[model samples]
Target: MKKIYSIPVFLTMMFLVACSEDFLDLKPIAMETEETFYKDFDALDMTATAAYGILCTRDIFDYYIFMGYASAADDVEVGGENTNDWPQFQAVDRLQHSPMLSTIFDSWGYCYKGIRMTNEFLSRVDKIRATDTKVNQALVDQRIAEMKFLRAFYHFYLAVVYGGVPIADKIVDPSMFSTPRNSLKEVYDFMIKDLKEAIPYLKEKSQLAPNYGRVSKGAARALLAKILLYESSYAKNYPGDERFAGMQERWTEALQYAEEVINSGEYQLVGINGERFASWRNPNGGVGGYRWIFTLDGDNSPESIWEIQNVMDGKGWTYTRGSYIVTYFTVRYYYRPSDPTHSDRVVGGWSFNLPTSYMVNAFGNQDSRETGLHSVPVDPKLDPRFATSIGRPGDTILVNDQTEGEKWFPMSFSNLPTQTISRKYECSPQEYWNGRTNDNEGPMNVRWIRYADVVLMAAEAAYMAGDKPKALNYINQIRKRARMSGNTGYPEDLTDISFEDIVHERRL
Candidate 1:
């Protein structure tokens, strides 16, 4: 059993006893308990690594592994083997979810697990100085900062989901579990504090290895800008809220941080004709732009700000090696012929988060994300949003086979199966079935943050701060990247940008 820390002391004790042997013998050869860890910088580094590893678990990052956040939005429906397949997910779609939802407990428990691990590291990181030389102090300090950034991230994750989650900044007394929740403002403030402190200690992406995927200075700052933007949203909808009294100033900070990231020059948007996807999985890997971004080829693309790493092998789903959870939820649940080798595709997804027709129509005038090459035979006129906005009732949707590219077709029973499926992260049939349970679990590295999102965020922050020209500039930057080079889409240059326009841009 996996040990879930960061809950009440009694509960953690009970789990320790139940999950392992005696609590007194917390130091097992199989695992390092708090009593044995943090003795040196290396141990602390390992602990920090473990903290980051938690991001891949089904509890937190594996929303795709189970029912995901998309089902709660209006653009999708919780589809599965049947409407009753996952009532908790269905309840989310119906706005009828309760505390009893397993996802609720899982998400909450896993986030706190991450928090607890980071907190433990922070409390004991200083112990490294006792034995390690002073020359390596700065490196130790950077790791500590990374832990702080991760702690802030997990806290923010809980905040957005639970509104005002308890700020588990430290290993607390058992009594803290029942402690009153902090205000959303308080949570944001705490997260912001942690991030700000972490920023100075982190290195730029260029300093790290190309595929390093570790948290860098840009990641921490970019995330801080996002958090501030979210806080600005609260202020926008409720101006009377005192916590956001200086919302305009906050917006200014958001823009500043965003620009800082852009100026760093360490990362860039994956361009329309970039070599990032030169040969992602095969020779026909020239699907530039949006489709290219989602493939395994773009794992460490310049456009990717931060992402969870995924190796094609796995000791377990929660070990963070690679994930098939996205395929589990996004792919159509049933397989055609129910055979492993007939060449029919898209037969194993759990059919969750099915796109609504409204979503299909929302992608108007562009297909960067929507109906681009990866789309079905839906109408050509659509926004470049929601990658699967195309495909007519009976149109054929292509599936990539691991050995070959886009050769097989989905074996569907319905006349218009593509209408209900999302092709964004679905793996090829061969790759999906390469292992025992890996098909439900696959090797798609889930991208948590990317440059396009940051660009839009900067645009929104500028608009909210009463800078129309700046907002238009930012929006246009994203728009330019969304289309092929030299083909800047409509409103070639927006003389003015409005809040509603920003909203529409975000939707796209």
Candidate 2:
């Protein structure tokens, strides 16, 4: 009887204890706890890496949201099977997007999501450094600098797209989730400060290993230059606009930073005068100075200041690490029954972000250009970038299969109303084969910032600062490269480049 009573007593105590809050308070053994995770250098670095993953995800840098951003420009039009397709993009294209828009919210939420990760990592780093002496201080410093750059990058884009966003430099408490937006000046000032502080600790492009897509000092300076240029342009364009008052003075600083990037000796143009980098990944080992910049071969080249790294593994639709955005831009095609393999031709795509006629005509008149074996009717007098940038109705597009070699066919798509496709970002056959899971995945790295873009920004800054000669010099550099890329004698350099010329060159 005593034994039975003791059993019941034990069972009751066990139940009560198990129900108590402290019962499950034990540290997680099989998993990681926040307290235990930041004790080492590698763990903190991994956290920084995870923060960078936000850039690779659909929430921040993927197709749907980016297409929405692109549609705002006249150069690109959102095309699909019909008007009902991808209404989010259509709303933005038509400038009818409201606060209820999902893409805007996604950008906002995911940007803050990235900021939260960086803030937490930074805060935890400080705490661990105070208490733990085993940490690698040097690596920690570099990682901290990287986080600052990334955080500022997010803020810069937000300010540009949706003026005066909230700046989150530290982890926010749940009670303070409704923080008010900062002024545009305040946001820009914060980004400038963070990037300047980070530049010293960040590595140069040359310091990083080949194909290392990490944030470098040149990227930081380039971004700083861009931010200042935008602010200066806004203020100059709208002098009475109080939001950008005094920003006109930033042109000198912008030019300084941009020139710094130009003179850094860490980057240069690839395929200058039709030269090819050994890194060029042409399936047939062909050469096109500017065209290869978008292919897998041109990734992480010296000309690329910053690129969003992507890989072609067998990742499915759920994965965002691959260049899924290319699929949207690629031309949609049907495999004919006679050529069921789609042998040597380009693969199919959903055909979004079709270039408008205004954009195509911007390149100038077309002429018959001579090929090695034949004469193809392309705009020889037009800007050489036309051949590399756009695949028109008469042009042949790339879809090289290694087994069958290179095959060229006329650009034909079933769903394209515009009857043209952007060739700059089409997925190569090599990338398609590598992404065995589906066409949705490709290995093309998104060239977010290139040396050419930096030079152009510098030109704008110089022009805004009342230095026309410097601006002309920069513009001429791009023209020279373009001439060489297409091996054309046309699109001659302007004797005196105007501000309009700078803008027009940028459109190309």
Using lDDT as the measure, the top candidate is 2
Candidate 1, residues 1-508, lDDT tens digits: the string is: 2344445776868877787445566546878666666556777777788798788775457554334567777667777667787777878778888877876667788888888889878878766677666438888778888888999999888877788878888987787879788778888889999999999999887787764668999899899999998887887777887644544347989988888888888776676443324533345745546666776666767888888887544556556466656554455523333366544344556655666666665554333333322122334232343443333333343454444554444445342332466556655545554444745356667787788888888888887788878888887676555554222242234456666566656655
How many angstroms is residue 173 displaced in model 1 relative to the true structure, after the best TM-score fit? 3.1
> Where does candidate 2 stray beyond 4 Å?
1-31, 64-66, 245-248, 277-285, 312-319, 334-346, 365-381, 398-406, 433-435
Per-prediction CA RMSD (Å)? 11.2, 6.0
Return the lDDT, model 2, position 155: 92
Model 2 error, position 5 (Å): 13
Candidate 2 lands at a TM-score of 0.86
The C-alpha local distance difference test score for the whole of candidate 2 amounts to 0.75
* TM-score for each model: 0.80, 0.86
Error of 2 at 113 (Å): 0.9
Q: What is the C-alpha lDDT of each candidate?
A: 0.67, 0.75
Worst 10 residues of 1 by lDDT: 371-380
Tell me the lDDT of model 1 at 319. 63
